[model samples]
Target: MAQGNIGGLAGGMGRFTELRQRLLFVLGALIVYRIGCYVPVPGVNPDAMIAMMQAQGGGIVDMFNMFSGGALHRFSIFALNVMPYISASIVIQLGVHIFPALKALQKEGESGRRKITQYSRLGAVLLAVVQGGSIATALQNQVAPGGMPVVYAPGLGFVITAIVALTAGTIFLMWVGEQVTERGIGNGVSLIIFSGIVAGLPGAVLHTFELFRDGSISAISMILIALVVAAFTLLVVFVERGQRRITVNYARRQGGRNAYMNQTSFLPLKLNMAGVIPPIFASSILAFPATLSMWSGQAAGATWLQRVANALAPGEPLHMIVFAAMIIGFAFFYTALVFNSQETAENLKKSGALIPGIRPGRATADYVDGVLTRLTAAGSLYLVAVCLLPEIMRTQLGTSFYFGGTSLLIVVVVVMDFIAQVQAHLMSHQYESLLKKANLKGSSRGGLSRG
Candidate 1:
């Protein structure tokens, strides 16, 4: 019996070799990513950058640093992070609706997808150049609290070099993402962001504990915070997995002489269809102006530009409100990009599937739209609550915990995605084992019958 049990375990293990190999490839790729994060861009003063980052504290730079796994603070090669690719993807997705040629290509299936991917890459390069130039300019005028320059060499050459370096870094990250998609598990780009967010967890936890130890944060408060975090995480899990199922009936057609009745199926629409993108996009947009302000030495002025800069400053009530609004706006905007009611309705109609009561085309589309709008409203509220709660806690408690709602959202979503991938692998392995066992039982039954 022991031998049999061992054999069964071995068989299960054997079935998981493919998944293990894929996971190994993913781990290796992530290691490569972490290493790249440390490679400094040319013409940057690492010391000066660190000082500048330290001075900023819990500002927009912290968000950038968190996403880049501290690469931005170090002025590393991966300083630009994956924002350029994200921006490119956003543009290309938007273009599909606006440009007829792009729309035509989008409908071409696999070949069209490849063409779009290429276009996205080109767009990434362009965005990287623009973002890199802006960042480089910011770095030029940025000085530490002690008045030391952030850039080692503050010249046109430094600007050009930094741009090229950051642009190349972003391009390399794009390639890494593609490789992970092809050869590893999980979405490569998402995984990169996941790695960055996870990297900061240790520091955040340590700081929280340190505050508690020093009596800066009471034990009771820490417990309360933990409970809140737990509740928020649970909320995210439920909402992320929440889906509305739309019932569809597919009428069977006559084949030869016999006619068959219809069959029923359901279309599942996720509550949070927009995923973690809204927060990221909102942060990117908000951070750009703050980064610019930090880079420029002149802070005190009665001018409109200074006023605009001050209003947009991180930790400000106005900035938080604007950021939340942008997050909500982007959530709706991105949801629209991913889900088109008209297109889905058309596909369902072409496939001979219709909602039980709704008409095949426009009515079906309208129904989907209505459902999505309600779902998006719920999603927007959830996002705002999750994101704002942490910020409010940080402000009220005055703790050094730097984990924002956006960071927590990314962490939770990525972790869920990673776990889902692993479960899929395990489920596939189990199915294979069950199939083999069924086949073996059938063979044994045949042998007994022959005997």
Candidate 2:
């Protein structure tokens, strides 16, 4: 897909140059983020922190670390990544439907969007503080089980500094993400997460190879893993691209004597309308209890918290049930929020279009809604199957099963989007060159006529 995007650039160095500049801009920004992933916050021992992560980051911590590009494992300033911002945005987005004031602001156009963004920023800052404070408090008790300290200096002073630094880091990353979206290529936050996951690919590959060689993973199992991953990727691409097209016909209109012909179009509804939002939301919410229990002074409540965390840990039956339910629920909820059949029916009715057999207004809306509900059901089931199967395998098979469906989903979708963006830039560049040549030719023809 990426190759196809850049293939037409052979005709003009200018387009290539422009594409290169955009790619370079994105690359440089990612480089900065990657560098920040290594810069540890004050009062934490980087080596010790990594060791602790190896010991404990098998669930929520690991998931967050992937999103942060391994910053969480490093206990770096960027440990929180843009999660605070993402969670904030999701909260505000959900609020739009729940709150009348937010709903009004949503319909206010570009100005409204800016206001919502500002609100999200504020929310992100607050979340950063809360999450950062949690990390600091958690660090106060972070021991390697064998008595090695993860935090070299742990106190109120350290906590305050850590919170401030962590919040600042998240804010900076938010700014970087904005810049990447405005000036570079693809979604910045997603790309950052993608970079982190892909960055670990080499090490994971080597580790798996080593395991296979050492008889830890048998030849048949290795072959099966590869085949399953390939099949899963194909399934994801197929479903992600799959769409249900509802045909609509527009009434003919006579403008200047001759009757105009009727026009036809189709409204495309994706199979997976909810996308990655459901799983991510589910994971974040489910991880909260464990995150809450990380406080150092929660010793009085430690036993209960530990039991709760254990029950909710990855591969646990309760965790699987809750996770699946949430994914399915959010799938429908977010799908409804995004694609309102009533709104669509109203817009089509206003525009003099009708879905062939369906009556206008209520009937059309009902038809659309019913179809959407069915699609969401199928999509949610797919989500549960794809996400849970991998985790189930990991629980039974072992911890080396790192490339879960969630990671694959993010990787596939983001890569496709990134390639699409690159293609857009390339197409735009080609058009610009064509316009310039046409303008020059017109000028030359005019000069010749004058002469």
Candidate 3:
């Protein structure tokens, strides 16, 4: 047993080559992104930007910067992060429902999807340019509360250069995200955000301990907080993995002779049909204004701008309400966008399949739609509860740690997806190994008979 264990790695040397390659690709891509986070844009004063961010501690873009893995704070080439691409995706998704041409394109299968993706990339570029320009213009005029100037040279020249650099950086990050998704483990964008959230966990731990050491947070309170975080983590995993499995029955069909084989399967619809996307979209959309206001504050704001910022800041009542509403809305909206009951019904009908009690055509579609609607409503409510309630409590508590609701959701879901991918790869590897062993055994048997 010991000898076999020692040789285990050698025996399975090629078993997970693909998985190893994918993991290496993801790790290398993220390392590149982290490196770029520190490589400041040429024209901007890196120190000034850092000082400004430090001075504004926990501002709107602070949360955004945290998610961007500090890209924004550094004013790096990748400062815009994946926001432009996400925004473009959201725009294209919304447009599909509103524009006939887009809707038609969406229904065109793989080729159509490629066209939509191309258009989305174009839209991302446009958004990146506009957003990059905004940041550039804002930085040019920005003065830190401590009187540190963010831009050394404020003019059209700086603005133009910054815009081009930032846009190119964002496009590069977007490409990296796509590559990660294609060649690596999890959803690329989500994984990027997950890495950022996970990266801060050690800091969170240290801060928590600091609070305890300084007698700021009582041991009981700290314990309670830990318990709560664990509870929420479990809840998220449960809800995210929960599914509504509808039994599907397929009618037997005529074969080569008179043989007919009936089939039974289940059509699974997840409890959270939108997955982690609704919250992500909601957070991204809400955070945009906060970012704008955070920058605009540096320009000596209007009362209105401050008011908007105050209203939308995390932990505020208005922010919570709007955030919750957007989450619920996006939950339904995204769920609808991704799932087509009519198409599902048609496909099932063509395959001679039906729900146990539902009739085959439009009836089945209606039944599925009804089920989905109820599921989405429950899911939206669950999302609001899990993602918002913690923020509200944390606001009331005034704690410093930020491993909050959305971050938790992103982390948990991404980890789950990553694990599933690993399992899938391992399963495939095992199958290959078994096939090779079987082939070897067959050849050995023929040789033994000859001997």
Q: TM-score winner among the candidates?
A: 2
Candidate 2 residue-wise lDDT, 77-111, digit = tens:
99999889989998998899788899999899999
TM-score of 2: 0.92
Which pairs clash in the backbone of model 2?
none
TM-score of each: 0.89, 0.92, 0.89
Off by over 4 Å in 2: 1-11, 256-260, 292-298, 438-451
lDDT of 3: 0.83
Off by over 4 Å in 1: 1-11, 57-59, 254-259, 299-302, 433-451
Q: Per-residue lDDT tens digits of candidate 3, residues 233-310?
A: 899999988999989998796677778787899999999988767887788777766666666664555567667767
Worst 10 residues of 3 by lDDT: 1-10
Query: Which lDDT tens digits does candidate 1 get at residues 345-384?
Result: 9999999999988998999999999999999989988888
Whichever of 1 and 3 has more lDDT, that candidate is: 1
For model 3, which pairs clash? none
Candidate order, TM-score descending:
2, 1, 3
Q: What are the runs in model 3 whose C-alpha is more than 4 Å off?
A: 1-11, 16-18, 57-60, 94-100, 103-110, 254-261, 284-292, 298-301, 446-451
Candidate 1 local lDDT, residue 45:
74
Pitting candidate 2 against candidate 3, the one with the higher TM-score is: 2
lDDT of each: 0.83, 0.86, 0.83
